[model samples]
Target: MSRWKPHVAINVRNLEQSVKFYQNLFGVEPVRVRRGYAKFDVELPPLNFALNEHPYSEVGALNHLGLQVSSTEEVLAAKRRLQEAGLATFDDMNTTCCYALQDKIWVTDPNGIRWEVFVVLDQEDDRVPDKQKILVEQPAVACCTACEKHSPLANE
Candidate 1:
């Protein structure tokens, strides 16, 4: 890839509901609408995101998406916008999440996809919620020595 813009194609259960939720959250109208899809070309950055209606499945609820803000103020502003839209907002102020110093708001869209708007303060060495600790505390492997030998890769 030649370092171009980023685009995300998400599967949604209801196109109308997802479009409305995204429009309210981003404070913008959909740039394009199709039979089973809606596209929002947010002008602030190079994010080209779209949602399409598809058959729902429990195995694939979230296909991964995130928003990285420039500053903490932006994070708070996003939270306020989400709250004003009457969306569910989960805030963890000055908390470490995904191994980064972040303040963010969490909301699930109509398709059960988690959306995260976050401003990162700093980087850390571990995933927040500490999965490794849980794994170590309750070792499910047959050999603890082999388990310790398998070093996990870092999240890209």
Candidate 2:
């Protein structure tokens, strides 16, 4: 069996300010920081959390939540289990999103909260030159049917 980490992603009005605040609160700097996103892999309370810069009016503070799996096999297995239980699942393979290349499968809980089982394939450097910023676009539509209809974050 692989380790499963609880993931929480939030929408922040300001990435830098939120990152600094969380660093102080958690007493550790983020392990990963990108242009508009940051991740804190905290061990004290056991959290795999991240923040993404977004206008508050578009989506409330909470973005989405997920489970970080160690391997693609785990993602597939989880997807299978969810599907077998009658939940709809959507898959995105080798997709570049959230500043990283990931393979993921998404599902929506009854309350319309989107959850994903994903494994990172590669992460882009945080300090990439400004010229490269223009080429980066917001991620395509998310993979959960319920979330897509109810949450603005699903299109981000």
Candidate 3:
């Protein structure tokens, strides 16, 4: 575990909803929860993420990005491990996020940034970032009502 692993933080529209979404997606419940912050000590595939509930209208651009795991069980196991570590964990069994079939967990650190640990079971090549057409969903959820609302991007 000496190798450094990158940790990312992002903002969420709703803490409770985001918490629930991650718990179900990753298959682990949060070990800690507060006003608008959550943390998960995710293991298995190895990811560090934090989630924060921000005013839907006040949210900003994504801070960083992430990669999905290979299995639903991996997501679930990660969730369980995180829960055991006394961190907040959320499991999304069969939900789609960021344009991929994912089982995931989410958390928010003290700084009010969001992070997600997920496994991609399937994908849709909708957003082509480069010459390689990899499946991807929109960057982040739209805060304004005028933005396109997708289930994965929406506040669960």
Best by lDDT: 1
lDDT of each residue in 55-79, candidate 1, tens digit only: 8655253333568889989988988
**TM-scores, one per candidate:** 0.72, 0.48, 0.42
lDDT of each: 0.69, 0.68, 0.56
The top-ranked prediction according to TM-score is: 1
Candidate number with the higher lDDT (1 or 2): 1
Residue range 1-156, candidate 2, lDDT tens digits: 277767877777778867765664444789999999999998855788888877655544445566677889978887777676566777877777776777887765433346667898777666878667544344666533323544435556
RMSD of each: 10.2, 12.8, 9.1
Reference-based lDDT, residue 145, model 1:
21
In candidate 2, list every pair of residues with a backbone clash: none
Instruction: Score candidate 1 by TM-score against the native.
Output: 0.72
Q: Report RMSD for candidate 3.
A: 9.1
- In candidate 2, position 64 carries an lDDT of 59
Winner on lDDT (2 vs 3):
2
When sorted by TM-score, best at the front, the candidate numbers are 1, 2, 3
Sorting all predicted structures by lDDT, with the top scorer first, yields 1, 2, 3
- Scored by Cα lDDT, where does model 1 land? 0.69
